[model samples]
Target: MKDKKSAKLNLQHKQHQNGHLSPSTFAKLLDLEASWDKDQLGDVLHWIRQIVALICGLLWGAVPLVGGIWLVAFLLISSGIVYGYYAIILKVDEEEFGGHGSLLQEGLFASVTLFLLAWTLVYSLAHF
Candidate 1:
């Protein structure tokens, strides 16, 4: 029993020294139970939004969706996904990230810019 326990601890220590997450920590993250520092969480949310924006932009361009309705749809879809991720999936505390507003707004501007650029470029290239 002692040898087994020591082996497990040694493995974990080696993983940490190699900059790898321990098995337990990896499991927690997969289960969305891991607590993330503010900056790390914020950056994760930002990248998530960016990815969503890129995919949505590409789809909208391919489908040739236009007008205010599409814009509204983009906003709804992007924000909704981000909201669901942090609030439902991660179950993070809203107050920790300065309420829902700041969390939702992270990387929003850059994402929108990316979306518009992708939309216009794809639409012009493919449709026109």
Candidate 2:
């Protein structure tokens, strides 16, 4: 009985691993993960856009500012930096759909970038 149960479980696991869950299995057709079938600018932009937006949100929310205006400008510039860093490091020629950089590689870039930004703000304010 145990052998039979194990066999059934193995078969189910193999099926799941095979990528056999036809893309159209869901009638509603919710295509969440960006399609990797095509290598294009749209996909690369999408990848960088997501991470940059996240960081922008974090900076905007985390900072307790007295400013009435510069907030929007700061987020915009940060987003630009994040996007630029990725484009430079990844090499614009490579299609981001099938990216090779590790989380540490990308995360390090982001961390260093945000750190510099924070340091700059701190120094600028310290003088003011």
Candidate 3:
């Protein structure tokens, strides 16, 4: 059993090295256990926030969400995900990235811009 497991792992590693990861192996690669530099981590957080913004904008527009509540919700969800990823999942030191404020603020403005753009576009096309 141990040998078989080791062989399977080796095969998976080889497959990954060849740039052909299965879904499960790909998911494992996203687990965030590898060491990351400050810039790389910040970039990851920025992209993650951007993706979250796009999805939330789409959903909000689809649901016809309007007013301040939706904006508040978007802020909460986007910040919450970034917090959870760094603080909980990655377990990185907040001070290294210049505290929670700086880390959370990464890509915030850009993501908000993206979110507003997507929301208005979707809402206008769908509702009006």
On a 0 to 1 TM-score scale, where does candidate 2 land against the true structure?
A: 0.29
Q: Ten-residue segment with the worst summed lDDT in candidate 1? A: 17-26
* Candidate 1 per-residue lDDT over residues 1-128, each given as its tens digit: 99999999999877664533335544554467588766666767787788899998999998898777877888899999989988999999999889999999988999999998888888889998
User: How many clashes would you count in candidate 1?
Assistant: 0
Backbone clash pairs in model 3 (N, Cα, C under 3 Å; residues 3+ apart or in different chains), count:
0
| Top-TM-score candidate index | 1
Which is the better candidate, 2 or 3, if ranked by lDDT?
3
Least accurate stretch of 10 residues (summed lDDT) in model 2?
27-36
How well is each residue in 1-128 modelled by candidate 3, as lDDT tens digits?
A: 99999999999876664523235543543576666556667767887899999999998888899998899899999999999988998888899889999999988999999999999889999999
Better of 2 and 3 by TM-score: 3
Task: Say which prediction, candidate 1 or candidate 2, comes out ahead on lDDT.
Answer: 1
Give the residue spans of candidate 3 off by over 4 A: 1-32
TM-score (all chains, Cα) for each model: 0.76, 0.29, 0.75
For residues 11-108, what per-residue lDDT tens digits would candidate 2 score against the true structure? 99767744333333332123334232322333334445445545654554456333525445654554465445444533343343334333213333
Q: Is candidate 1 or candidate 3 better by TM-score?
A: 1
Q: Residue 62 error for model 2, in Å?
A: 2.7
CA RMSD, predictions in order: 7.1, 13.6, 8.4
